[model samples]
Target: MFFSAESGQINHANGTQYFRGLEVKEFSEETATGMMDSLLYAPCDYVITQSYTCMSREEAKKAIKRTRRLLMSADDDAVSQRLDLDVALDLLTSGKIAYGKHHFSIMVYSPSLESLVADTNEISNALNNIGITPVPAEISLSAAYMAQLPGNYNLRPRKGELSSQNFVELAALHNFYPGKRDKAPGGCDGFTAHPVRRWLLYQPA
Candidate 1:
């Protein structure tokens, strides 16, 4: 009933190196709740959701410049040496570039306090594995959950400073593209994080 982690859709057996998505030792009872999102409201005993929002161009530019200036004047010599900041600054100064920041929020819900706590802890740890620090939505839990819905972008609880490039890398958007490229000699077909398992295959009783 479980997927075999070893078999992946990406067939880069030699040259390509795939980014390690997550490194959790085990899945939770609530693991299925977070991964699947549906348009219809099929209320469950628990719900855990997260959202990432892209900032406006003007706001992002100003924020980027302000952060750069602060780093430029800071006494720490290492802050300016960070490659992420340099790339962001170059995008702004080099010429016209599409760049922005993203605000994000995560919410975990359960009918009982115990499951809620466990699910939140599991999800938070998973997020941390991929370099995201989950901050509890103190006074903004409702807003954070609501923000997961479409047209509720304004409900994001915190101002996310993550760059657009970083967001793209984190999201599945940059994973792999399909087209004539797939038809090309070395190109791959659309891939999935989950691949079929022998245990799940049909067998005669």
Candidate 2:
């Protein structure tokens, strides 16, 4: 048995299991590559990397390009409503996308609609630019949890025109939006992409 997070391995043979804490984390990338490479020479009947695939590399690229055009031209109102989508996509390209045996969840916390929408395209473009094909199904935390868990969240517009300030307020709840108190000159004065997730444990009624 092996634990990826800590990179520990357990060896069991001869009716006994030996436990050892090897310096596996430092060698994880190389070890993983070596193991997978061995599969090229001989097939092994085992699972690898928990297996996450959303769309083919080609599909993700197409989806991202289409979405990016929409973002650059979308109205402030539309941007405010769809930002969570963008963050989720960015995470996918960052290799943060995860899936289970059956269901998949795209997790982002407190995302403004605009950032979510825009960042998704950015992530898609980033992935395509890097040549890693990802197939990710999309899900929104707010829509999924609103009825069960809504909070005192509100947005305020900066300059009363651009949606930047409004989007920042919406994103803070998720820890993805950076504070507007200070920013670099000539840099985007609005929110940037940060992605997060929350876990819910519901009791049966």
Q: All candidates: CA RMSD in angstroms?
A: 15.0, 24.6
User: Which segments of candidate 1 are over 4 A away from where they belong?
Assistant: 1-59, 80-83, 93-97, 173-205
Tens digits of per-residue lDDT, candidate 2, 13-96, equal 633221111110111111111222322221111111111224543455455556666776774356643464465456545665
Assess each prediction's global lDDT (C-alpha) against the native: 0.45, 0.30
Write down the TM-score for model 1. 0.53
Q: Give the per-residue lDDT of model 1 (tens digit) for 9-124.
A: 12344532211111222222222222322211222223333345556667667777777677777855765345556676677566545554355444444434455556556666
User: What TM-score, to 2 decimals, does candidate 2 have?
Assistant: 0.20
Candidate that scores best on lDDT: 1
Residue 198 lDDT (model 2): 25
Candidate 1 residue 129 C-alpha distance from true site, Å: 2.0
Best by TM-score: 1
